[model samples]
Target: MDPKKIFTTILIWLPSVIITLFFIPNALDKILHSSEMNKIVSNNAILIITGIFLLIATALFLYNRTIVIGTILLASYMTLIVFIHMYKGKSYEVAILIVMATIFAAYIRSPFTFQQKRNY
Candidate 1:
């Protein structure tokens, strides 16, 4: 493997891995301990559902074929989290960072999805 290839592979996958690491535990916690999570949100069902959604999104993200959809779902999730944190007067920096990382990773993984062809 060439050094450039190694570097590009790392750049493309590292962010996604980091984001997955961050979310998987949270998702499991929500699903397994929805009772505790209910203190933050009123509905336990919503927490469990969100956890399942996170798991599905993360799975999609890890697979090359569905990376775009996963990126969109994860970014959307993080955007909602950002808003919730803002409404509560909490720092939303981490959620914002996750959204940026998700998009960056997706772009690197599939540049064609983001490229716009010029008619000229």
Candidate 2:
């Protein structure tokens, strides 16, 4: 593989790995009724649902065939999280990182065609 491509892959996958590590454990916490997670989402049902969505979104993100859709899903989820944090006056710093990571990954996967060199 080209060095540039390797670097690009790393850039894409690094964020993905970080996100997976974060969300999987968080989802598990919600599923297992961890007190820490419960503080953020009081209702078990809502927490479980959100966890499931996170898992599915993460799965979609990890698979190359669904990268675009996964990025979209992740972005949407992050946006919701940002708004929730803003509403509650909580720091949304992590959410912002995830959002930027998703956007960067998506761009690396499919950059703008207009920015590419064209053949006559």
What C-alpha lDDT values do all the predictions have?
A: 0.88, 0.78
- For candidate 2, lDDT tens digit of each residue in 13-99? 776787778778877777776445635667778888878887888788778778778778888988988998999999999899889
Clashes of 1: 0
TM-scores of all predicted structures: 0.87, 0.74
Best by TM-score: 1
Of candidate 2, the 10-residue stretch with the lowest lDDT total is 106-115
Measured on C-alpha atoms, candidate 2 has an lDDT of 0.78
For residue 24, model 1's alpha carbon misses the true position, in angstroms, by: 0.9
> Candidate 2: which stretches are off by over 4 Å?
1-12, 34-36, 39-41, 110-120
Model 1: residue 76 alpha-carbon error in angstroms: 0.4
